[model samples]
Target chain A: MNCRQARDLMSAYLDAALSPSLRQDFEEHLQECPACTAELGSLAEVVSLVRSLPEKPVPDGFHQLVMTAVAAAHPAPRAAKVPLWARFDFSRFGRVAWAAAALVIFFGLGLAAGRYLFPASAGSTAYVPPSVTAKPASYDATVATGGNTVTDTVAGIGRQVAYSAKMDLQVQDVRAAAAAVSSLAEQNGGYVEESKITTGWFGRVSAHVKLRVPQAKFQATVDQVGAQGKVISKEITAEDITASYVDVTSKLIALQTQEQQLLDLLRQTTSVDDIVKIQKELEDVRAQIEAIKAAIQNYDSLVAYSAVEVNLSRPLFPWLSVVWPGLGGP
Target chain B: MGPQSPENREALLVQRCQSGDLEAFGELIAPYEKKVYNLAYRMSRDAEEAKDLAQEAFVKAYLALPGFRGEASFATWLFRIVANVCTDALRKRRQQEVVSLGRQVETSDGEVMLELPDAGAGPSDVLEDLERQHAVERAVRSLPAEFRLVVVLRDIHGYSYEEIASIAGVNIGTVKSRLNRARQRLRELLQDGELFEPHNVYKTRAPSKGGAGR
Candidate 1:
């Protein structure tokens, strides 16, 4: 091999990447040419020095810093299941755009807050100011309210929203908090859907209760339960199911109409085969109508009764409590 | 009971992280933080920049963890993210003027010399080794970003050609060529320092009587 060829293969030779035959030829050339041998040795030494370079020590509290940043970037949700809507792609907009949009939403909601605050007046028709109604024709006002349902002219009855809340409470007495929550739910014509209480070693107590309360009394019940203890955290979510609700309700209506038409045809039909065919289609439509009705019923229940999850905890040793000293007294 | 294997532990942690457990993600990254920091330090040659790059890579990895399918080991996947992050940082840094290490230093007599770090009070052999190591480091740092990456992955980290190709998003042939060119450049740079000039045994010898002999 010429010096040029030997030089090209030197790195591969060092890496043991060359084929046996090529390696033999390269080794022979290296023995014959001291220049290539010395160059290879120098390369080897350089590689060795680089590999031996001491690793730079990581700065102290790196793990803590990383965890802090991670927590800030993604706060751990109390509920294990993250809502689908919460994961929406808000990253497509720049920060400035998001801020501007948020400002608009805040002012718009402030104007509409009075209407939403009084549940008794929810059925009353409120006048939408001309300025608010004068949006451009191209603008999709239905989408502005979120959900896919176009509620422009439809009655408010079609607008079904499910409300849920989660609250963490540091209570002086877990049992007392649990009883208060259950009593609040009962007072609102509701009940506890699920409850878990654990008393660990040293008499430390914690309770988790999932309460279902009347939608009209959701806020009142939450406030009363929250007043039972010091709330450490709270989250409230409203999910509009108007699109799915409207879709299923309309489908059920259409299927019912079809079923009636089939029944009329069944009465007039004389041939056995025609009767059988109509009856088969009638059965299918009836099944679909039943399924849609079940879905609407589910939505109705979810809308009628909101879910509230409350977590209450107390320290194991009363004297060990640093933050809640007054509550620490046995 | 026996301890859980790393693979099982990693899988469990990944599952928990997917479920929005940040603590589990922290545990998952504990073993790789140092490796990642070292890689970042080598790439940027700035400690502060390395920390930023490492932190950014971890944050990105966490956000993208939901989409991770575990097809490759987490380390390989994380290395790919680190490489991309470092590349972007270098590109941004390139927009500003960057002083190359070991460039010419002028003395009072206007004589040019290679810029080097101050040699601390050490024995001669130790000082010599330190100087040579610094020269080699500067040479590696002076290489083009692409060549420098491949060389670091291959020679320093001791990754296989295929693994380098995967992390670098290049084919094996590209990796091999880049590594070869990088080593050749390093040799040239070191020769200017006379670190390897004395070892070039054939430089004083005459040409062979038979040229290109088989």
Candidate 2:
């Protein structure tokens, strides 16, 4: 081989990468060429020197550190099951926004307090004056002198006892049951004092009834009304109005007496100024007597009857929507 | 084991180390670290860089042990890694063109050249001359990047052509060719007039580039 060709093949030969025949040819060339042989020797020495260098030791904690990193990358399996709210860091901007919303709600409620919750004081209170000014107070006499009054009229009614109850029912037909309850009140010698009914699709049906049953048949009336449906909950309350009835009755009598006196004064007065004053006084006393009579009637109605509130609902059976996979073909 | 039975002990250590025993791994490295470090030092020409490369190789080998597959001997694999790391360091240094971390001193007569600061110095003093050291360092630094890699891997690091090929990911033929070209360049560096005057005289006497008298 020429020098250039030999030089090119020299590296492969030194590496023992040549075939047997090729290696033989290289050996023959080397034997005939001292310069090439010398060059090969120098290259061999270089390879030897490089191969003789020392090996270094690995640094400490390498395995532990790598394992620690791996463990962090793949955490314990239980971490996936934690709820998002608890897992999320509340220290972030989301937490700040949440606090801001809460602050706004509290601040709004604090501002609304003055309008809705202010208690009146004599000077601090702002009362709206009427369009027509109030007339000044006046006096009158000689209308009734000493006779039957409003208080004597209210005291003539007998004493009464009150009863109330709250009942929760589950009925298939709320309207039918409510009608049946009203019919039962009439049959038991009672009248409907107050009655109301409200209906809607969202399972919230309720009826309120204040029925005055004859005092002797109160228990029987309650029992017959309760046979309507399954009762989920119940509450009953009873009170006697004997003392309040008597006191209101006597006060009503006193106001009627004053009213009769003012009416007699009006009849006796001849001058226009005296007559106008007497008529105003008479009207005021009569209005007070009317108020007392209305109060006594309200108390008598409450004491003689029982108010019942029935909360009703239709049964709802919950079901999950089932989507059958590929069952129906069109 | 007794000193006379060192070969048997070494074989036993190799066996145990291959079986994944950490104590055996430590024993295997203890006797070889210094040799590996020196090889790395010559190739990288920096004590610190060599040490780091050597350590990196050991760590790499340890991490790769589980997948070693035992295709070649463990020592051979380790040497391949060390050569690779040193080559990588050299390549990085070359890209940045760093000079004089540490290099040898050679004389014009093809001998290592060192100069003594004082005329009348001790025997060790002559071996530690700064001017001669600088000259040798410049000669090595002046080599082309490709030639330098082959020379450092083969000559300074003492890697076999096959090991160099494995580490360098080249065929053995390429390694040898590169080494030859590197040697030619190194010889030229040693012979250059600027390097040493006596080296010029030896250069004329030395055989030319071609085969002898062919």
Per-model TM-score, in order, reads: 0.51, 0.35
- DockQ (Cα-based) for each candidate: 0.41, 0.09
Backbone clashes in model 2 = 27
- Give residue A124's error in model 1 in angstroms: 27
User: How close is each model in CA RMSD to the real structure?
Assistant: 26.4, 41.3
Clashing residue pairs for model 1: none
DockQ-based class of model 1: acceptable
Give the top-scoring candidate (lDDT): 1
lDDT of 1 by residue, A94-155 (tens): 99998999999898676456544544444433222121111111111222122322234423
For candidate 1, give the lDDT of residue A123.
47
Off by over 4 Å in 1: A75-330, B1-3, B100-123, B197-214
Runs off by more than 4 Å, candidate 2: A9-330, B1-24, B98-149, B156-159, B193-214
